[model samples]
Target chain A: MDISPDESIFLHIGPVALNATIVYTWITMAVILAISWLGTRKLTSESKMSRWQNLLEVLILGMKNQIRSISHQEPDKFLPFIGTLFLFIAVSIIMSIIPVYQPPTGSLSTTAALAICVFVAVPVYGIAKHGIIGYLKYYLKPTPFMLPFNVLGEISRTIALAVRLFGNVMSGSIIVAILLSIAPLFFPILMQALGLLTGLIQAYIFAILSVVYIASATRVHEEKEQKFEENRKGKE
Target chain B: MLINWFTVFAQIFNFLLLVFLLKHFLYGRIISAMNVREEKIASRLQEAEQKMMDAEHERDLYFQKNKENDERCAGLFASANLEAEAQKKELIENARRQVDEMKKRWNESLREERDVFLSNLRKRAEKQIYIILGKIFSDLSNTKLEQNIVETFLGKIKSLDHTERNHIKVILKESYNKAVISSTYEIPVEQQHIITAEIGDAVGETVEIRYINSQDHICGIEFKVKNYRIGWNVDDYVKFLEREVNKTLEEELAG
Candidate 1:
């Protein structure tokens, strides 16, 4: 049995190949896109709305609130990246309920790609707030001697983020597969149910962690701005 | 083996694309709609507050107007009451004056009516006395009323006192010795001579007696010399009776 959807190659064009990972990722993307289009095609600011619109609003507002609480700032900036991470992970994991469906999140490459996106986004947002010179200066905090360790810490945490998500999602699928072979009926269903819960929890954890990282990177600029305002007031 | 390089890159592209698409479709539209609804609610609240303020101002204005109207009404009512009181007093005074004028006119009319009654009484008394005396002379004495009248005139002249004789004498002298002897009827020659001789003896002068027939003597004789007069007539007796009657009536009214 393939442990990752990446192993199930569907086509090959010399060095390039199509696999279950890419195919299921496209499917997940398609599902997300279709639902988003349907929900927002006739968006209204009025009080009355369709159930689908309400559901979508609830979802988007919930993510924004979550991001706002973690970042302690406006959620609008971080919402797109963090919200996509949660929805993609959760939906990919939930799709595993269908027979013969391989969750794209169960693939190590997919999780790594998501983690790399978070890793890249942290500095991007930080640089957007404080400029590249100001953002890079955070690594040299406490002392220049600790800069290498801070850089290492950043690399290690990105690897941990990727590995942690992959391990959790892959282990759940593997356990359900092993249980299907051993008991096949009640235990596999129970494991699948447990997997659904863990899948949602993992998505939450991943989104929250990304927000924390991004917030940490951008928080220095906010502190500087606050201190500047205080100094200006003191002068006044 | 687990981490495919191509797939990882492909997934990264997919995730970024998804973010871009979701931002365009969902987050941007939803946030904008929420903001618009919030702004609309805020503006509506402001409008409602303004309307409430306007209503309160109108209420205050109405209250002020009502107060002014009440004051004006009270002032008008007080002035009207004063005017009405003044008019009432003036009406009462005019009524009293009219009543006094009417009372005075009534008294004047009563006095005029009393005068007319007294005059009529005097005339009637005179006529009645004359008629009664004529009847008494014819019934009792078997003599003419003219003879009795002439005898009475002669007797009055003969009984004159010394001072009354001197007065008649002076009057006769001033009258060119012409005396007018008027009677209600013509006297007989004998009675006339007796009257002339008695007057001449009393005065100690020959008076030129002019006998006049007149109705003014009231059935008696009147001897007049210019403004001076001496006579015996029913008029004297009637005047004395009228004076006594008037005195009695005054006493009765006083009582």
Candidate 2:
């Protein structure tokens, strides 16, 4: 149950090890706070914020517009969870740089907890917009024969979202750690930069996929499918 | 580096609290402010349009009142002209009447004066004729049969139609006038004189018996008739009066 971050020789306390991860975590949090503040300081509908501001705003606006495009209901209502998911994944992966540091996202347990939170919130919002009875109906697929398969598909897809982010971030951190130890100098910086790219990509995918999943659970995806089916029937 | 369950849970709680505060305070206020701004701009535009319409109405009222005033002035001018035309006609009528009345009065006065003048001339002629008769009788006194018999004899000679009987009366009674009355008996050239003189060329009466001058009293007198000087005496005087009387009569009749 105990973990040592980045395989560094570290001093130990009762349950935790104070290693390079601790120091890098603080730096990463500072970066996130400063960047998020700058993004919100001047908000205009038409213009773009700069640098880290642009990165954070893109994360927020991308998720917002995506949720809105899918659900057609109040997408901004989900901006808080979506913004948190985006920041957490990105900051964890970016912390792979400091010596003896590790990304928290590589842990399945962490990804699973986030996925459970999303699962719980989706039903809550659905029950709020549409009553409890309306929320349960979404589990039964439009064709009764497809019900069992559709339910299994929904649960499997959520599990897939969590596992995918966990495996990719963990593999990237371990590979780069192995490569840095082998090459010892120039290659480690190259591997570190690659790790950063992998980190940002994983973060964007995780946040985007989470919004789409919530959008589906609220019957937003089902409604779109119903219309598409009708259009096919009309054309035929 | 490693999992911290308590810290992870605490972080989640903080994130939820942050979202709740933002939703209630910031988002709600910003949206409502935008709505209020929209309403204020709309109201200001509405007020501006209303004021412009009011200005147009005022201009229409002003022009209408001005048109009414101009019509009133024209009406007054027309009334004054009508009054002046009436007065001008009245003056012309009065002038024509006055001219006619003045002409009538002038003509009447002139006719009366002419009548009086002619009557006075006739009376003077009659008096001169009597004076001539007395003078003839006195001159025939040596063979006088009284003046009444001479007048009766002259009257009888005038009633005769032939010159022979008139001549006989003239010779026997010795009438003052011995000229023949017949057309064949021309006037004796000796009894007529062409006196080309004013009063300074006058001579007195002449004696018929001697065919000579008698009285040297009246001035610029000529003895035109030999039997009884018929010059500026009674007969000449009476003849002049007769001609003047005739001219006056002609003027009165013509007028």
Best by TM-score: 1
List candidate 2 segments past 4 Å from native: A1-63, A95-101, A143-147, A221-236, B1-255
DockQ of all candidate complexes? 0.70, 0.05
Worst 10 residues of 1 chain A by lDDT: A220-229
- lDDT agreement of model 2 with the native: 0.56
Give every collision pair in model 1: none
B23-75 per-residue lDDT for model 2 (tens digits): 44333333333345446666666777777778778878888888888888788
lDDT tens digits by residue: candidate 1, B1-255: 899999999999999999998888878887887778778878888889998899999999999999999999999999999999999999999999898889778766755676677668878888888998899888888888888888777778888899888888888888878898998888878877888888888899887898989987567899999888878889888889878877886576456
Per-residue accuracy of model 2 over A1-236 as CA lDDT, tens digit each: 12323234255677665443343444555555555556545543333335544555455556667767766657667766776677767777776675645665665545655665666677777787667876676666566777788778767876887678777877777776688668878887887788789778988787777777776666674575578679999999
Task: Report lDDT per candidate.
Answer: 0.88, 0.56
Cα lDDT tens digits for candidate 1, A126-155:
999989998887787757999999999988
Indicate the worst ten consecutive residues by lDDT in candidate 1 chain B: B106-115
Q: Which residue pairs in candidate 2 have backbone atoms (N, alpha carbon, C) closer than 3 angstroms, thus clashing?
A: B191-B224, B201-B220, B202-B219, B202-B220, B202-B221, B203-B221
User: Using alpha carbons, what is the TM-score of model 1?
Assistant: 0.70
Indicate the fraction of true inter-chain contacts that candidate 1 also forms. Answer: 0.93
